[model samples]
Target: MNDINREFVSHDEALARAEAGVAKLAATRNDRWYPKFHIASNGGWINDPNGLCYYRGRWHVYYQLHPYSTQWGSCHWGHVSSDDMITWKREPIAFAPSLEADRDGVFSGSAVTGDDGRLWVFYTGHRWANGVDDADDNLEVQCAAVSDDGVHFEKLGVIIDNPKGFRHFRDPKVWKQDGMWYMVFGMSTADARGEVLLYSSENMRIWHFEQVLFRHPNPGVYMLECPDFFPVTDKDGNEKWVIGFSAMGSKPSGFMNRNANNAGYMIGTWEPGGQFTPETEFRLWDCGHNFYAPQSFNTVAGDTDDNTDGRQIMYGWYSPFVQPIPLDDEGWCGQLTLPREVFLGEDGDIHTVPAAEMAGLREDSTDLGVVEVKSGTETVVAENAEAMEIEMTIDLKNTTADRAGIKVHATPDGSYTYVAYDDQIGGIVLDRQANAFGDRGYRVAPLTADELAADQLTLRIYVDRGSVEVYVNDGHQTMSSYSYAADGPRAVKLVAESGDLTVASLTLHNLKSIGLE
Candidate 1:
């Protein structure tokens, strides 16, 4: 069910192959966080973040690649790696469905490094035999594979295929703590309530089923995709290990199902012997239009010398609904948001920020001192500003404008990265039309209801060599985009059409990471 990409395939053949890869369904148009090597196309489906672990001096990311059609098929775990999280190198197929139970496709899974320093993958076994199926039993059961070198993996065969009750349970996150291996997976009951289950093992195999960590109330009945459990400690002495789940329910959006296959978090204290707060009440990590399938790296970030003294950093596939922009003409679709450091806030709430290492990616910085924009005003960035950082405010109360926004990371071809508050359009729009990241074309993410009515909007737009992230009103809403405009005349612009809004302050600084400091 797999074929090698001929090194010397003709242009037409390569185009066809690329298009064939395009046929594979893609979902969760990831925020503009991915580096250049990662690419995806129009909607179909995308499951877990694959090959997600630090191995042998580098970080690896494998995704359920359905390169033939956007519709979920024989999912081959596509591979890519990076040393600094900046420059990435795409490798060959990491894992293809080579078993009967998982024949329909490799499905989605997480990558883990065992105590032996070998990378072990704990994924679901779906499809009957022929890599395709449509039955209750054909869906999911856990299976695993091992890899010494991140690229080549040896399927250890069925590790544990759907043990005991519950018709559907999949997407396992494995980790070793206190001398025992543990796996947390998303599950569903016969009544359709979504649940997160726990399993433990002395070694990598022979596991005992634990209790359901948490489950959905009702509307989110179908199934939860990826489940992660880890500790989140902030600057103070507060420590809370969080258990999270994501639902991909067939239910529509409403009080019942705000996000189809949505992602949420729950804070709890870990009990003895691989058990957790089983009666935990789940809450949201963020109330945004997109955010789902969040996974954590096993590597303890910050001063790796003491793994015990690190924070649980997270990376989620921000799943945005397809609207306001078309994906076909763009050629590529979704991109992941930058890795983030997740921790507990002093208020006992969760807090997240772009990974500290990403700050090193800043290039040039600029500051425009207190440029005021009434209700309806537009402005362009000055020259010599390729990469930039901006702090601007729009006065929504002063004027009756339908929309107002600031644009940066612009190209001479008229394509630019924009972060605007559009009352007429509703929501904050991170428009990257002409400069579609990875040729995926323009993407517009509307702000949540509360976001649109913030009264005033504060925007921070960061432009790297090929990526841009827009954070509004102190992380109220964030839309990240990935694109390569190394040659484009990068600048910033502001547009406040239909309103007499005034700007509080507009400061741009050259990227500190690019020696412009």
Candidate 2:
């Protein structure tokens, strides 16, 4: 194999080497835990998604790329495109750390379409001058690149420098509002309180700093990364703003309180003066074991006040734990979650459902209708399916069980991960403690009062080799997690803790691999 990093005079040379490396690995490597449908690095390493946008009737996703190895190092931008967000086409390395300004690495950012129909990318250029080990040595500046066509790009140099007195600053998320360009970057105060700084640009090149959009009030949070903001209707039929950020340090309170490395959003209203008025408290975006650094984009028509347009979509890095995977043997690690449609629920919460086009990947489906399980477990569909989609409705009102839901990824010995609705807490829990093949943890995300008031609950679950993503009540809530196990006759069962539990309807689809072959 060629040295991952050799001489690079131009972007083409770097791309050719990366392409060669991935092709070599694909020819001889097979990891059972490699996902069948998710987007992963072509060869080396990928982290937070950089730029995501719609161009010429397709969706393009750019991610933090280190083409040398599966371990973190200097960064570049890896490109992939999809017509329907299900099957992705890997493009060449779009942005690399070639320019003097970004010689160290090209970090995370966002993408947008210019008024003249050109595609624009905004990213942070990172360099460590004083020392690599000290956080005080970090230096990052916002930069821009332009592309006449979606595949090729030309660097435009540094656009914004680090403001005075800030220790770390990066991850520029740019969007257009009322015909003006607004940019938000993750930042922190000198005292180590995390916040987002706002800026406005009349032209794409020059930007003027505004004010701190919002800050984490908790003293335990040191800093926040990958901040994203957008407007959506709240549950009360009122338009509101949603801001999301990834936090580091001890777990904060109010939303999903368990995970120490927490990622969530706050529902609020934005004034024309650029200040945000939080309407409701902060909440967890996804209560999954491995979800972070989420970025969302609009793929179709714009969203209305009621969020009826159904075009807002999002994707998050599968995990930030940086644990070793079987695929490390092939010189790659990390993946992005499936694209989900985001909308404001009627209960003042942000909700996400699988993109509509995912249905196209369902090859053979079975309709298991109205099964009753009393104080036991029953296999409803396939004995076990690694890549499958299950949609079922549980009659919570009529059921007498204290707790009920489905058991998935079950081994023959009854060791399996459980996804169930806890009647006592009136929330959902995903237990992966027994499945230590990958990361082991339990995640619980609560449902709103309106969600639990219903007589029936609906669940849509997508399970691939190492991931389990569940959508509750048509995406009013969602939990996404990752796990691994050996391939065999795993059990897919309807579980009831006590008393009769009735399944109103169940449908299981053995999903076909999307571009995995």
Candidate 3:
């Protein structure tokens, strides 16, 4: 095949070239910072979880990929499948820039099992005008593709053209409700207001525009990308609708929305042909440095093991955009956060916990039961701390310490990443400043005075080769980030800043790597 990097290539040729590129890179690549238990690209670059669905007795996750290099370029769809969401098997490059509509890129989209026993994918087809790759000089249209075997797909051409009064339009998320198909697209008004446009389709091909479902109240939110609308049952068994989107150029407040882009959701109500009425304000999904463009998956009817429990699972891209990732030099970049089971809480907030399937990854367990520290840090686990799961509970009602929590991925030198509860901030903080190769900053998940007075702060943390995911207080709050630490003895430490602190219980489990290498 001719070089696919040339100005033009056929669809088949693009897929062949991508396979050859992955083969070439796998022969001579060795990277230490790659994730052990996350869904990452085999080579090149990946971002934005797309086309998430359960089909043919397995879970499928498609993502935005650029297989030619470790930097962003013309996008393709990378594929992976798993019986459980934890152990993944890489598939072939699913979609390339094949047709005129998507000649430049096959952007982000969603998937569903059609009524005819086929998997249907709806996505944005992006093309550059006159070979200029500027934002204002491009074409974006909604398109669809179908797969009979759940592997290979055939394009069905453009489904929705670019509408007027919108400068930026992309990331189509489709679903079925009330025996009819509905789709939501993230768009920006000509005057720079972020909006989500709703549409209805009868056959999942022809779509008619409905009203704007939800609009950003703030003028600073320039664009909303990858909008997902779905319903989740609260603790009281009442179904509530949720609308999630990634906001670009969003105004920063406190430690939230401090990145170049952030993912958030709103709880609201919506009908088939009416606008969304939000009952709560916008809330951030994960307060971390490297999270964006999260998508959710609920099993459709006639699928094997139909998810009748109303469980909604989500995965977010665990890396930020336009930043210098340390792993980019190793011929691959990016990972997806662990699959999280999301639900509505009694307090009317969206709550996410690591899915129950993650427990299958635990191996040798070490119980460091009930360790206490006074006015300083103490070593909890002296070694074998690089990849493990930690479960701990701190007695907040009985402790008088100003700050106390656990630190992981630490070296003998004064370098470590920590998750601590600070009395001054009245929140839990995840700090990665001391040992990070890039992207250094901390995130705070605020807590109320009533919560602190209730007596305990429970934490479940997962530390991988170059990343960490922290779930606090039974998923009341979560923080995830990438931290490339210096080489030394991997140790775990517990800290108490000013006074005595008591730990009710603590246990550490050495986790098994999925062996992506």
Give lDDT tens digits, candidate 3, residues 462-491: 988788898888787888888776677678
User: Per-residue alpha-carbon lDDT of model 1 for 253-359, expressed as tens digits?
Assistant: 43223454566677777854645663345565544344567787646521143322354556666454534323322333344556666666554556566666665
Each model's lDDT comes to: 0.60, 0.77, 0.83
- TM-scores for every candidate against the unseen true structure: 0.73, 0.91, 0.95
In the range 409-508, model 2's lDDT, one tens digit per residue, is 8876556778888887788888887784666767777877876888888999888877788898888778888767555766687888867788899999
Worst 10 residues of 2 by lDDT: 1-10
Q: Count residue pairs with overlapping backbones in model 2.
A: 2
Best candidate according to lDDT: 3
Between candidates 1 and 2, the one scoring higher on lDDT is 2
Q: In model 2, what are the clashing residue pairs, if there are any?
A: 235-346, 235-348
Query: Which runs in model 2 stand beyond 4 Å of their true positions?
Result: 1-9, 24-28, 131-136, 234-237, 250-255, 300-310, 320-330
- The stretch of ten residues in a row with the least summed lDDT in candidate 1 is 1-10
Between candidates 1 and 3, the one scoring higher on TM-score is 3
Candidate 1 — which residues are off by over 4 angstroms? 1-47, 128-137, 164-167, 234-236, 250-258, 273-283, 286-290, 301-309, 318-325, 328-331, 382-404, 407-458, 462-469, 472-492, 495-517
Local distance difference test, candidate 2: 0.77
RMSD of 1: 7.5
Report model 3's TM-score to 2 decimal places: 0.95
**The CA-based lDDT of model 1 is what?**
0.60
